[model samples]
Target: MNSQSPQTVLSGLRPTGRVHLGNYFGAVRNWVRLQEKYRCLYFVADWHALTSDYADPSKIRQATFDAVADWIAAGLDPKRSTIFLQSEVKEHAELHLLLSMITPIPWLERVPSFKDQQQELKDRDLNTFGFLGYPLLQTADVIIYRAHFVPVGEDQASHLELSREIVRRFNNFYGNVFPEPQPLFTETPKVPGLDGRKMSKSYGNTIPLTASADEIRALVMTMFTDPNRIRRQDPGNPDICNLFQFHKLFSDDATIARVDRECRTAQIGCVDDKKLLAEIMVENLRQIRARREEIDRDPSIVWDALREGNRIARQHASETLELVRKAMKIDFPELR
Candidate 1:
């Protein structure tokens, strides 16, 4: 696609901690593929991180750097896609403020995550205005870029629906200055953690993307498998095995079929099966780990790319804000 007419795709991730296997298969891999066909903008959502992690804001900066490094290691090229930090572009806050004025409290309250997160994170005092209005800020994140599509998994469809509704409401009041961004649904496979649950950092069950070969093996050895397989001679169920789910992603078809048959017939043990998976996972991530090492040697690589991308993002965001001001009849010549 050419620079002038490529379809724009925008997405971001909260800078909570190091990326894990779930993140690579669920989002970053798809992003890498999208960059080849579209104009992609990926950002570290540091400000969004503050919505939930405001109690301790000290980690946001370092987390942003680490997240960007993982993105690059996972094959997101800065030359092909704009990589940035959300807080660096002040226009996002401005747009979020403007959007919040038109967005009703009831609308934000109806979001599924609003109630879900409040209950899930009962320790945090989530009654604050910032927590309530983050969805509006998320709307700003998308429409500020005037993105044609927002890549999302099925569970996030409701969040993007709110963004679309805000775009419609804004256009109804002002002129049509923003496009209603559409969802590009992604088929992300389920990546279970070592504990046989959905892989998440909060669960403390993640296998980080930058883990060493020994670490990978150690972590894989902890993965939960079929509970019925009590003895080495006992028949195992690959269908219910968490390790088998991982095998589907990293192992070849031949290996997968062999493992399935062997496990069922008592020809192989979980220890041997897990060891093979660990080896395959380490080899699969060989190049990514090497690139991560290069970035670690010089942390400036991530910062420099984000700096240039912030410049590009700011330019686009400034133009969008100007149009918004004009549409709302707030752009007075005397102010300039």
Candidate 2:
């Protein structure tokens, strides 16, 4: 296989079990489209998962598989993209350590997510070195591949900027070996949950991408609409309604226009609108749902694809590590 995918795009996802509609529309779908245009390396960031969920550590293995199955089900073809588990490629650890030695303590602390995550997961004991240094590890994750682009949402561009700074610092000290990765900015749709909040699994308000038709129907039926529209005759505000946002994603253009127009005129009720969305969601998800089930029946297919990706990624990682070793003056052949 060609190891050189010019202008390569590297990205990974921390295992979070099956993905919800928010995950699919906001990111995974963009990953699928990316495979068609660039040489993409997609990985399961299992090691990154430990940064927060180290207490239990039991769910990582299963959640990794669940996430990959959904990734394949959503359209991330193994043949088109290099898909592997991050831990399987050990070179990442070596490079991460090398970067950490030169990185300043203030650099890691200043990363926005550092304090933000600690506050969000306040219950967890996050004083460990792993949590503080995870951002540097992320720098390793991208630079190890010398990836040129990393697909990220608009809000996440700042997070990727730190990786660029670290890379520039490394190059200035050790000579330039890695490119400053650019953000492949993408359009992310804001999907709402059943209770009118942002759709999230933690919120217990997600509709999974692999949900069956019946399950989809039940979930959508409970979705919140315009709260002020109390009666069938009362005019509704589609802009404020949560289900209307979903309709924009799943429904046809004509239906969306009609719904918007009639919603304000009080011609269409919330129940009827939800019923329409449920059917549309079921239909839109039918192919992915079937693919996910087929992948579920034969888990080996997913693992086999991942194993091939592992082989490909390790080759690239080994080459990069050698360069890093030479650049850092750590490659002592006599010792070996």
The candidate that wins on lDDT is 1
Model 1 pairs whose backbones collide: none
Candidate 1: regions farther than 4 A off:
1-4
Tens-digit lDDT track of model 2 for 1-336: 265635799999889899888888888999999888898999999999999999888998899899999999999999999999999999999999999988999999999889888887899999999999989999999989989999988888989989999889999999988889999998798888889887887789999999999999999998888989999999999999988899889989999999999999999999998888899989999999999999999999789988999999999999999999999898999998
Candidate 1, run of 10 with poorest lDDT: 1-10
Name the lDDT value of residue 9 in candidate 2. Answer: 94
For every model shown, what is its TM-score relative to the native structure?
0.97, 0.96
Q: Specify the poorest-scoring 10-residue window by lDDT in model 2.
A: 1-10
After TM-score superposition, the amount by which residue 151's alpha carbon in candidate 2 deviates from its true location, in angstroms, is 0.4
Candidate 2 — which residues are off by over 4 angstroms?
1-5
- lDDT against the true structure, per candidate, is 0.92, 0.91
lDDT of 1 by residue, 44-77 (tens): 9998888888989999888888899989988999
Native-referenced Cα lDDT, model 1? 0.92
Model 1 TM-score on a 0 to 1 scale: 0.97
Top of the candidates by TM-score: 1
